[model samples]
Target: MKFVSWNVNGIRAAVKKGFMDYFNEVDADFFCIQESKCQAGQIELDLPGYEQYWNYAERKGYSGTAIFTKHTPLSVKYGVGENDSEEEGRIITLEYEKFYMVTVYTPNTKRDLSRLEGRLQWEDELKAYLKELDEVKPVIYCGDLNVAHTEIDLKNPKTNVGNAGFTDEERGRMTRLLKAGFTDTFRHLYPDTTDRYTWWSYMSKVRERNIGWRIDYFITSDCIVPAIEKAEIHDQVLGSDHCPILLEMKEF
Candidate 1:
C-alpha cells in the first residue's frame, strides 16, 4: 500500500496553498501529517475515502498531528504517556490488524540547545514506547523527527555540527532507535544517495539554494524491510518548510 507523510507546518494554511492538489495527485492509502497547528473542529477537510484522526496540543495553533487513512484502524492512541501528553501534541498511533502505524512530530531542540535535555528524554521514552508496541506487532513509524541523522542528511554537515538538530546527542538517539530493530526505509533503499532533503530553512534564499535537512522519514520494523517498495521525498511539492515523504509497501 502507499503511505505518505508530510509536516505541513499548518494544515489550514497548506490547504490554501495547493495541499488539496497534491493530496489528490498522490492519492496514498494513508496520509500522515505533522505540525497541523489546528484542533478538531478548527478546520474542515473534505477528503473522500479517508478516516481522519488528529491529536491537538492544548495550546492553540501549536504542535499537532493527524492521520488520514483509507482503512479504519482497530484502535487509535494520542500520545505515548501522560508526561509526554502535556506539551507538544507529537504522536498519533493507529493500530490496524497487521501493524501499528505511528506518526510523530518530535520536539525540536531550540536554536540555543536549551531543550536538548528534554529532547533526549523524549527519545528514550519514545523508543521504550515503540518497543512495547513492537512486542505485540510490527510498527510503521513516520514523521518529521527533527534530526539530520548523518552528514549525508544535510547540505553542510560540517557547518551544522553541534547545532540543535544536528548535534551528536540528537543523532545518537536516532542511531539507538535504528539499532533497536527499526529500519529507516529511505536509507535502506538508497544508502549512498546524496543531495536529497525534506525540511528547508525559511531563511532568505535557503530553499532556493537547496540548503535543507532530511529530517522526515518512514521507519518500520526490521522484519518488514523486504516489503519496502519505495521510499521517496517529494521535494518539489511546496507549502511548508518541509515537503512530503512517501513510503510504499505491499499491504500486510
Candidate 2:
C-alpha cells in the first residue's frame, strides 16, 4: 500500500494550485493532509474513490487536518483527549483493520517561543494517545510534526538550533516519542541521510536551494518495520511550505 502525507498549508489554496492534479498523479491508497486551514462547509471535494475525514480548529482558518482513504476505516476519532489541544483540530485517528492511521498538524511554538509550553504539553498528550492506541495495534502516524528531530534532519542545524522548530525542547519531545516504540519510517530506511528535507522557508529562494527541514514524517510502531518497503520525500511538489512524504508498505 502506498501511504502519503503532505502539509497542504491551506486546503483552499492548495486545490487552486492543482492539488487535484497531484492527487490523481500520486494515486496513494491512503492520503493524509495537515494545515488544511479550513472548516466544514467551507469547501467541497469530489475525490471519486476516497472516503474523507476532516478535523477543523475552533479558530477559523487555522490549524486543521484531513484524511482521504480508498479503504474505509473501521472507526475514526479526533483530538487527543485534551480539551485545549482538541480545540485546534490537530489530530485524527483512523482505525484500519490492521493498524491505526493517525494524522497530525502539530502546534508550532511561535517564533518567540511563546507557545513552547503549550507545544510540549501537546506532545505529552499525543504520546499518551499513541501509546493507548498501540496497545491494540501498530500505528501509522504521519504529519507535519513541526520539529526537525536531529541535526541530520535539518539543513543548517547549527544556525537553527534554538529556533522554534529546532529548539532542544521540541526535539527532545520527538525523541521521547520515538523511544516509546515508534520508528520514523524515512530515517529508518536511510539512516545518516542528509540534505533531503520536507518543509522549506517561503523566503527568498529557499526551496530552490533545498534549504529545508525534515519536519514532516511517517512513523510506525516497531513491529511494522518489515512491512515498510520504502519511504520517500517528494520535494518536487509545491503548494505548501512542505512537500509530501511517501511510504510504501506491503499491504494495509
Candidate 3:
C-alpha cells in the first residue's frame, strides 16, 4: 500500500500548476493534502476511483485538509476532541479495518511567534488524541506538521533556531510525541539524509538552492514500523512551495 502526503499550499492555485497531472501519475492508495484553503462547493474534482473527504476551515480560503483514498474508511472524524479546533479544519481521521489514518495540518506559530502558546497547546491535545487512538489500533499519521524536529531537518538550523517552526518549544513537542511511541518514517529510514526537504520558502532562489525544511512527515505507531517498505521525499515534484512525501508499506 502506498500513502502520500503533501501541503498543496492552495488547492486552486496548485490545480493550475499541474496538480491533477501529478495526482494521476502517483496513483496513491491514500492521497492526503494539507492547506487546501477551500470549502465544499468551492471546487469539484473528477477522481474516478477515489473517495474524497474534506475538512474545510470556517474562515474562507484559510487552513484546511482533505484526503482522497481508493479504500473507503469504516469511520471518519474531522477533529481530535471538541469543536474548538474544528474551525480551522486542521485534522481528519479515517478509521480503516486495520489502522487509523490521520492527516493534520498543524497550526503555524507565525513569523513573530505570536501563536506559539496556542500551537504548543494544540500539540499537547493532538498527542493525547493520537495516544487514545493508538490504544485501539496502530495509526498512520501524515501531513505538514509545521515544525522542524531537529537540526538535521532544516538547512540552516543555527540561523533558524528559535524561529517559528524551529523553536525549542515546537521541536520538543515532536520529540515528546515520538517518545510516546511514534516513529517518524523518513528519518527512521534515512537518518543521515540531508538537503531533502518537503517545504520551502517562496522567497527568491530558495527552492532552487534546495534550502528547505522537512516539516512534513509520515509518522506511525512504533508497532507499524516493520510494515514500512519505503519513506521518500519527492522534492522534484512541483506546484506548491511544498512537495509530496511518500510512504509505502506492506498491506496489513
Candidate 4:
C-alpha cells in the first residue's frame, strides 16, 4: 500500500500550481492533504477511483483536511470526540479491516508564541486520541504535524530553537508521542539522512537554499515498521510551501 501526505497550504491555490498533475502521477493508494482552506462546494476534484472525505473548519478559507483513498474504508470519522470543541477541522480517521488511518493538521503556535498554550493542549489531546485508536488496532497517522521534532529536523536548529515549531515544549510532545508506540517512518528508514525537508519558508531564496523543516510526517504503529517498504520526502515537487511525503508498505 502506498500513502502520500502534503499540507498544500491551500488546496485551491495548489491546484492552479499543478497539484492535479502530480496527484495523478503519484497514484497513491491513499492521498492525504492538510490546510485545504475550503468548504464543500467550493471546488470539485474529478478523481476517478478514489473515495473523497473532507472535514472543513467552521471558519471559511482556513484550516481543513481531506483524504482521497482508492480503497473504501469500513468506517470514517471526523474530529476527535463527540463534544470536542475543536472546530478547525484538523483530524479525520478512516478505519479499514486491517488498520486505522488518521490524518491530522496539528495546530501551530503563532510566530509570537501567543498560541503556545493552546497548541500544547492540542498535542496532549491528540496524543491521547491516537493512543486510544492504537489500542484497537495499528494506526497510520500522517499529516503536517506542525513541529520540527529535533535538531536534525530543521535547518539551523540553533537559530530556530525557540521558534513556533521548534520550541522545546512542541518537540517534547512529539518525542513523547513516538515513545508511546509510533515510529516516524522517514527517520526509521534513514536515521542519518540530513538536509531532507518537507516544508520550506516562503522568504526570499529560502526554498532555493533548502532552508526547510521536516514538519510533515507519516507515523505508524511500531508493529507496522517491518511492513514499510519505503519512506520518502519529495522535496522536488512544488505547489505549496510544503511538499509531499511518501510511504510505501509491503502490505497492510
Candidate 5:
C-alpha cells in the first residue's frame, strides 16, 4: 500500500499551483493533507476513483485537514474531543477493518510562544486519544505535526532551539508519542539520514537552499515497523511551503 501526506498550506491555492498534478502523479492509496485552509462549499476538487473526506475549520481559510482514500472506511470521525481543535478542524480519523488512519494539523504555538500552554495541552489530549484508539486497533498516523523532532530534523538546530517548531516542549510531546508504542516510519527506516526535509520556510530563498524541517511524517504502531517498505520525502514537489512525503508498506 502507498500513503502520501502533505501540508498544502491552503488547498485552494495549492490547486491553482498544480496540487492536482502532484496528486494524480502520486496516486496514493491514502492521500492525507493538512492546513487545507478551506471551508465547506468553498472549493470543489475533481478527483475520480477516490473518496474525499474533509474536516473544515469553522473559520474560513484556516487550519483544516483532509484525506483522499481509495478504500471505503468503516467509519469516519472528525476531531478528538470538545475543545478548540474541534472548532479548528485539525484532525480526521478513518476506521477500517485492519487499522485506524488519523491525519492531523497540530496547532502551532505561534512565533511568540503565547499559545505554548494550550499547545502542550493539545499534545496531552492527542496522545491520550491516539492511545485510546491504539488499544482497539493499530493506528497509522500521518500529518504535518508542526515540530522538528531533533537537531537533525532542521537546518540550523542551534539557532532554532527555542523557536516555535523546534522548542523543547514541542519535541518532547513527539518523544512521548513514539514511546507510547508508535514509530516514525521515516526515522525507523533511516535514522542517520540528513539534509532531507518536508517543510521549508517561505522566506526569501529558504526552499532554494534546501534549509527545511522534516515535520511532516508517516507514523504507525510499533508492531507495524517491519512492514515499512519505503519512506521518502518528495522535496522536489511544488505548490506549498511543505513538500509531499511517501510511505510504502506491506498491505495489512
Candidate 6:
C-alpha cells in the first residue's frame, strides 16, 4: 500500500499549481493533506475513485485537514485530545479493519514562543489519545507536525534552537511520543541520511539551497514498522513551502 501526506498550505492555491497532476501520478492508497485552509462548499475536487473526508476549522481559511483514500474506512473520527483543539480542524482519524490512519496539523507556537505551553499540553493529550487507539490496532500518523525533532532534522540547528518549530520543548514532545511505541518512518528507514528535508522557507532562494526542516512525517505504531516498505521526502514537487512525503508499506 502507498500513502502520501502533504501540507498543501492552502487547497485552493495548491490546485492551481497542479495538485491534480501529482494526485493522479501518486495514485496512493491513502492521500492525506494538512493546512487545507478551506471550509465546506469552498472547493470541489474531481477525483474519480477516491473517497474524501474533510475537517474544516471554525475560522475560515485557517487550519484544516483532509483525507482521500481508495479504500473505505470502517469508522471515521474528527478531533482528539481537548475539545478546544477541534475548533481549528487540525485532526482527522480514519479507522480501517487493520489500522487507524490519523492526519494532523500541529499548532505552531509562534516566533515569540507565546503558545509553547499550550502546544505541549496538546501533545500530551494527543499522546494519550493515540495510546488509547493503539490498544485496539496499529496506527499510521502523518502530517505537518510543525517541529524539526532533533538537530539533524533541520538545517542550521544551532541558530534555529528555541525558535518556534525548533524549540527544545517541542522536540521533547516528539521524542516522548516516539518512546511511547511509535516509529518515525523516515528516520527508521534512513538512519544516517542527511540534507533531506520536507518543509522549506519561502524566503528568497531558501528552498533552492535546501535550507529546510524535516517537519512533515509518516509515523506509525512500533508494531507497524515491519510493514513499512520505504519512506521518502518528495522535495522536488513544489506547490507549497512543504513538499509531499511518501510511505509505502505491505498490506497489514
Q: Best-fitting candidate, measured by lDDT?
A: 3
* Model 3, span 28-61: residue lDDT tens: 9999999999988999989999999999999999
lDDT (tens digit, per residue) of candidate 4 on 1-252: 999999999899999999999999999999999999999999999999999999999999999999999998998888785534358999999999989999999988999999999999989988898899899999999999999998889999999889999999999999999999999999999998889999998999999999999999999999889999999999999999999999999875
Which stretches of model 3 miss by more than 4 angstroms? 82-85
Specify the poorest-scoring 10-residue window by lDDT in model 4: 78-87
| Candidates 1 and 5 compared by lDDT, better number | 1
* Better-scoring candidate (TM-score), 1 or 4: 4
Q: How close is candidate 4 to the true structure, as a TM-score?
A: 0.98
Query: Per-prediction count of colliding residue pairs?
Result: 0, 0, 0, 0, 0, 0
Q: What C-alpha lDDT values do all the predictions have?
A: 0.93, 0.91, 0.94, 0.94, 0.92, 0.93
Off by over 4 Å in 2: 82-85
Clashing pairs in 3: none
Per-model TM-score, in order, reads 0.97, 0.97, 0.98, 0.98, 0.97, 0.98
lDDT of 1 by residue, 92-150 (tens): 99998889999999999999999999999999999999999899999999999999999
TM-score-better candidate, 1 vs 3: 3
* lDDT tens readout by residue for model 6, 110-194: 9889999999998998999999889999999999999998888998999988899988899999999999999999999888788
lDDT of 4 at 208: 98
Q: How does candidate 6 fare on TM-score?
A: 0.98
Error of 1 at 207 (Å): 1.3
Kindly list the per-residue Cα lDDT of model 5 for residues 1-252, writing each as its tens digit.
999999999999999999999999899999999999998989999889999999999888899999999999998999785443488989999999989999999999999999999999989998998999999998999999999998899999999889999898999999999999999999998899999999888899999999999899899999878889999999999999999999999976
Q: lDDT tens digits, residues 3-56, model 2?
A: 999999999999998889889999999999999999899999999999999999
lDDT over C-alpha atoms for residue 95 of model 6 = 94
CA-RMSD of model 3:
1.0
